[model samples]
Target: MRSIQALPEFHVFFNDHVVNNFNTLFISMPSSKEYYATGVSGSVHNRLFPKASFDFIHTSYSLQWLSKLLKELVDKQSLAWNKGKVSYPNSAKEVVEAYKMHFGKDIEWFFNARALEIVSLEILWFFLIPSVADSHCKCVIIAVFDLLGSALMELAVQGLVDEDKVDNCNLSIPDEIASLIESNNGDFI
Candidate 1:
């Protein structure tokens, strides 16, 4: 909040969902900063402010979540169905593609919505996790979802957990910065 207040004559509007602790946010504001502040409760995927209302938008570790899961992944008959898995494994080519497509659509929607609310050439900052570098110059990360799914499956096999619960679990991976920039024609950056 202080960082935003540093910009001369800038008013900071912090957005969060209804479940957020807005009181704490308001209470924490230092009396020294003269800038005005407001809390908006809503999803960034949709417009929260009027047209050309903001000069800067900042998001951290939030854009990775897709608006919804890929339809094909949930459809049992679809080729992208991810049976027995909560997320795409490195070997699951089709699952990876499905996630990528879903991410692309989500990003496009986010930018389109933001385009209506933000002024042209206004700054947008998104802090995201980068892919892990591997020995073969490839990007890889320890599959936390795979571990979680495996644990759930083990419990189901032992009759300690419901198979249906395990079947319903799914996770989304964050897009690489390059893909995000490319998806929107590098306009948002």
Candidate 2:
């Protein structure tokens, strides 16, 4: 809503469970680009939180923007060939490859960092873009929307495209969280 500088230091912080008496700090940024500029730093995390640290990490629509995983894939595919056009099957393969080569690491690292913050018995719920719940139901409302979005962009441009699809694939982050908690059994809260 407002710039991180304009808000009180703690306004952006939230702790679902209050432990000890440490306060939740909020570091709100005005725009997504700036929000990311502020959010993505190991140094910024340390500085703004100079004497404080987190016990849990939570996020909503923000992670998608930060990674720009899908958008990057689309851009790469669109530029892969001469005449500014890519073949249908090639486009699909390029997209998949981009995801595998690029976004895969970013997603893995992001969650790994988050997993370290959660303690035993803590739950992290994510409302993701391609949400797990609707992943398989092709006829679901959002599935259609995803199809349309793909169609409007690469699918239509590439032609001979039978179905434009966005797989609502969901990942099991709880296991990662549990592993982190178990690994640090006696080290933290």
Candidate 3:
């Protein structure tokens, strides 16, 4: 927080796909702050800034939502199609692989896009609820999603929820930080 206050001048850009809520965001910005705030409404899968324009970038709990679900999961003819579950569990190997593949592509796209926008050695802080198993693990987010999927499955069994709708939904958890490092050639830390 001190580093933020110490900066000479800075501009904070809030980017999202939704434009209607931006007016509320702009109004909430402090008028007395030393920095400026701007909103850019778009998908992060594409470039959002000019080359070497940002010194720092931060993303929190957003990258898990892929731009689209995995192709095989949506294709009716594919054997790897996710027919019943809204999200992947360890039990479903093919579904898990599909989610992982999609996540890898999404993360690669994110890093490549940011690499163009961020200056050399600049910082990129990604805050996510890691899907790691530990003694002290409290993965509430994952648990909530799992519960939701379970609920949807139950509703589908009761003929209340559409099976296709549940089958098409997925939330990816990119837990392989080392893989991301390796894929990006160690350019980002």
Candidate 4:
């Protein structure tokens, strides 16, 4: 069994808390193996693991980064800062739709891969960015904003600021991704 979830501030904080409480075996190590990185909906299933090899899986705050919806819309402004124009958010509906499609598919693959795992109890949790709730504790919100702003500035320099686009789609919740996971698993807690 495997668990797939978003990577949110709360999730990170909670993970650390649980680790501290349980004194469990947790390794804060970077990947030593060469791993493939792609968009959320791209092909994590294949890159992260072979077919049905994992016993458990976990993803947090990572999937939201794949939301090309807002990224596509902000892409126009991204280009204004630069000169390259591969695809603008305002270019066509397909771009936005493509973003959504990729995001949805990413969610699907995450769950499907987890279902193929052999664990008996898979626990999945997630965290989302730019959360709508006011309970985020000001520190987390400010930190996330600072990080996002800095990354956007870098993207602006590289002519890739589609990340700053208008957020018309309210798809910033882990629940949406969690739903996909539950659809494939037994229960969601």
Candidate 5:
């Protein structure tokens, strides 16, 4: 639980889409901020830094975004075509499995890039809300996503948005990331 305060000197980097205002982020800095701040632009799935550039890396409420939408989900001919759904709560087995498979790759991209970027034997801390296998929580979450789908359907009915577009969209429900880590044959673990 030791913080950067323990270090006499440390650097902090902020990363997000290229469209984010880096000036605003730097301007809203803490009064006691002692570390250097650098803003990195682009997807985390790609390499953003040189090897051994950092000793510690951390991810917060990000990482939910897949590197890209699964081609199968977007293709009409694919069995994984998630039709008319914003979330996978009520999706078919094929659709759900497709999402899980895609997430595995997306997460691997994130980890693989970090593995190359971070210093050897250092910590790579990340945070993500994975879909729990619990029953009550599952039911509640299913209801919520179903409601969201219904809302999008209403928008489509009103002609505010294209129905086909809504059908093409799919919200992420990441499977157990711990399992992904366990299955890794890499040296990071």
Candidate 6:
């Protein structure tokens, strides 16, 4: 960052999906003499910049979001119909497969786009030195989400939220994401 005198000045792009509040970001962003900030709004699955536009790119707590909800989960006739559950935990095999396949496609698109946008020999730092949480901690988080789903189910039972609404909803966590990043072997980073 600005503290590093050895590195050249770099442009900072604050990005999010198109609906992000850019005004708040601009107002809240730290003013720096060493770098200028630009706001870029778009999905990483699609190119948000010209080829070789950046020498560095970073993402954090982002890949957990899916590109979009999988249609198969809402389609009652589909094998992947995910009724009565919001998260994939304890879901049917078909549901897990659907989420896995969707994650694969999403991350592929992500890599493809980043591959085009970055300069050769530049750093993507996509993982950004992720700190692994222990399994028990991960389970606690998943358990929290499960409790939320259970509450929604209770509401559906009381005719508060329609049952179909619960069926169509899902939380994205992409369990296969770590493997996907490793499989790329630095080619797309």
Give the best candidate by lDDT: 5
| Cand. 4 Cα-lDDT | 0.43
The digit string of per-residue lDDT tens for model 4 on 70-151 reads: 4443444542231222222322345445544665676666555555542544555445554322223354544554455555
Instruction: Give all candidates' CA lDDT scores.
Output: 0.71, 0.37, 0.74, 0.43, 0.78, 0.76
Report the C-alpha lDDT of model 6 over 111-132, residue by residue, as the tens digit: 8888888786467675521222
Best by TM-score: 5
Q: All candidates: CA RMSD in angstroms?
A: 5.4, 12.8, 4.6, 13.0, 4.2, 4.6
Q: Residue 144 CA error for candidate 3 (Å)? A: 1.6
Model 1 lDDT-worst window of ten: 132-141
Measured against the true structure, the TM-scores of the candidates, in listed sequence, are 0.69, 0.37, 0.78, 0.37, 0.79, 0.76
lDDT for position 11 in model 4: 15
Writing each residue's lDDT as its tens digit, candidate 2 over 95-132 gives 43444444334555555555555553265565444432
* Least accurate 10 contiguous residues by lDDT in model 3: 129-138
Give the higher-lDDT candidate: 1 or 5: 5
Candidate 5, residue 148: the lDDT equals 82
Ten-residue region with minimum lDDT total, candidate 6: 128-137
Error of 4 at 46 (Å): 4.0
> Where does model 5 exceed 4 Å of error?
1-7, 27-35, 134-143, 185-189
State the lDDT of candidate 5 residue by residue for 119-138, as single tens digits.
87468887866564432456
Q: Which scores higher on lDDT, 3 or 4?
A: 3
Q: What's the candidate order when arranged by decreasing lDDT? A: 5, 6, 3, 1, 4, 2
lDDT, candidate 5, equals: 0.78
lDDT for each residue of candidate 3 in 1-189, tens digit (9 for 90 to 100): 355555477778888886559988878878886777888987786689999998888888778778776788888788668666555553256766776777777777788888898887558887765764332344776667778888998998999988888888776766665677786787642
Candidate 6 off by > 4 Å: 1-8, 30-35, 127-138, 157-163, 182-184
For model 2, give the 10-residue run with minimal summed lDDT: 166-175
Off by over 4 Å in 1: 1-39, 89-91, 120-122, 132-141
